[model samples]
Target: VQPVLEDLDPALEEAAQSLGGSDWTIFTKVILPLLTPALLAGLSLSFARSLGEFGAIIFIAGNQPMSTEITALLIFIRLEEYDYQAAAAIASVLLLAAFTMLAVTNWLQSRALRYTVKG
Candidate 1:
């Protein structure tokens, strides 16, 4: 996010200011639009990372059999119990969810990029 902010052309804000745009107007009409793609990318990446988070949670919050609601943890428990079929089913569900999220993010990114200048 910092890098993206720094990479933005100062001339955009300058031009907006010269055109009598207020600071808030310049931000909403100029900066936010430019930053939207990076914001979406950051959010989606963090969400994907959190979805796969298991080891840290297990280590910090110990496993309470059948009580945890986290899918990754649930799959781990099933695997430990030698219930391969159950683990596979749970894994398939997780995979489907992750793929769905990926698809949505891609769709949103494409839509956002539609108005972006190629240069």
Candidate 2:
């Protein structure tokens, strides 16, 4: 994240410069506003990825029930324990959460795009 932001800083500065006025003004007025979509998208993607993260989390989570266990790990544990219904419930919840987050991000991105186009 730091590296990506650092790389983007120069380009953002250049864009601000092209827009006219001082660097600070350009950064505050133009560059920051323009970065909103990218920032949100990055955040949403990272969150979704984290929610679905199983392998790495399971290794460190200890797989305790209702403790450090993530939804994915819970599902795996349920399956291993032969609790098919519990596994299915956990899977359904995970799917619903993922889909809801994705839908929200899509909606926000669409609204941002519309505003950008109108502006």
Candidate 3:
């Protein structure tokens, strides 16, 4: 992220200069606001991916019941134990969580769009 920001700084400076204004004013007034949505979207996607991650976490987690177990790993464990009810419950919870996150992301994107249009 730091490297990308460093690379972008030069381009952003060029853009602001092209607008015929001071660098500080252009950055604070224009670029910062415009970048908010992209930053939020990246964060939201990363968070969602982390929530669903199973394989990496499985090796690190102790897999104790209701302890270090993540929802996805819990589902796998339930399947192995032949506990369909518990597996289904955990799956439902995961589904709900994913949906909630998606909804929030959508809302944030919409808000960004509105800001871009109105600002």
Count of backbone clashes, every candidate in sequence: 0, 0, 0
Model 3 off-target regions past 4 Å? 1-29, 117-119
Backbone-clash count (model 1): 0
Worst 10 residues of 1 by lDDT: 110-119
lDDT of each: 0.85, 0.72, 0.74
lDDT of 1 by residue, 22-100 (tens): 9999999888877888988998889989988988878877777666558888887788999999999999988998889
Which ranges in model 2 have alpha carbons more than 4 Å from their true place? 1-29, 117-119
TM-score for predicted model 2 compared with the true structure: 0.66
Candidate 3, poorest ten consecutive residues by summed lDDT: 1-10
In candidate 1, the residue pairs with backbone N, CA or C atoms under 3 Å apart (3 or more residues apart, or in different chains) clash, namely none
What's model 2's lDDT at 19?
Answer: 71
Question: 80, model 1: CA deviation in Å?
Answer: 1.6
- Candidate 3 residue pairs that clash: none
Q: Residue 83 error for model 1, in Å?
A: 2.0
Task: Pick the lDDT winner.
Answer: 1
